[model samples]
Target: MSTVQDYASRLSDPGSRKMGTFSYLPPMSPQQIRKQIDWIVQNGWNPAIEHVEPQHAMHSYWYMWKLPMFGETDIDLVLAELEACHRANPGNHVRLIGYDNFSQSQGANMVIYRGRAV
Candidate 1:
């Protein structure tokens, strides 16, 4: 008995979705992203980057930028991968997804980064 309007309203609610450490906030800067990656590494989680064409603002199923960085203690390497993904997929939506084997096998954290407008 839910109508299309109800679904649309929920989808449009900014508070309904939470991405990584930020919610209803602008994209984080490179330094902020590096800090987050460092935290994830400290917690013993693996990080990976993915990207999508971004036909919609909240599109999922992004393609992987490269293999997940497991046991990678180098924050510079993670940042480098992020930059590489952004360079290769300009105008697309990129995300950093973390995996925690201690609890969930995948998607421990996720942050979306909008690419430059074409």
Candidate 2:
């Protein structure tokens, strides 16, 4: 088995990972996360949450958390749901998605939580 140092070394290698958008950004504070939710609401983007084991994070499909929050404008509500998802599936990689209804595709996708050290 690869030791933590080995895993860390691999992760440290440039181009070793090609994950979601937020994965590139520094971990967001709760306030920052709230702002992101607000941006989603302001743009009228449909919000959804999905999660998967860290090892399977590169897989295309992740288990959805309940359903998409359609027509949801309350940032607090979205934050609460994200918290619930993380609590329910502790140590799972969690992501937030913003689907564009007009384009019928995902407009924004980002990793909100990355689970590891299991």
Candidate 3:
């Protein structure tokens, strides 16, 4: 298994040719995209309690994928935490409709919340 330092070194090393940057690549191939999606799904999904607005919820999907270290179980725990925190928040009235990996209304590849439309 790769250590944290190893992963950090890989990310920070300028000389090493890595496929980490999204800037150089255009839209990924179907297989590559599928692998990315699978990885993200395996890590898990979690909503941000402080930013649970319609836009935030929709944007959460992209944000979740951007986080490099999280795993599927971590995501499940995070979503649970968000839900509990959101429910306990004294002033906010936002509700979590839960996460859907494949949102048909949005698109097959897009992950989204199945709640109020933003």
Per residue, candidate 1 scores C-alpha lDDT tens digits across 1-118 of 8754322224455334444446445667777788888888888989988887545435646688879987887989988888788888778767777788687676455555665432
Task: Tell me how many clashing residue pairs each candidate has.
Answer: 0, 0, 4
Q: List CA RMSD, all candidates.
A: 6.1, 6.9, 15.6
Instruction: Give the lowest summed-lDDT range of ten residues in model 3.
Output: 104-113
lDDT by residue for model 3 over 1-118, one digit each (tens)? 8764333323233323222244234545545544544554553542222323333332334222223222344445544554454455423323222234355121122222222322
The residue ranges of model 3 lying beyond 4 angstroms of the native Cα positions read 1-20, 46-118
Ranking by lDDT: 2, 1, 3
Best by TM-score: 2
Give the true-structure RMSD of model 3: 15.6
lDDT tens per residue, model 2, 5-114: 33232444332454765765578898988888888879989999998887666668899999999999988888889889999998887888998888999988877877
Query: Which pairs in model 1 have colliding backbones?
Result: none
lDDT for model 1 comes to 0.70
- TM per prediction: 0.72, 0.82, 0.23
Instruction: Please give the lDDT score at residue 71 for candidate 3.
Output: 33
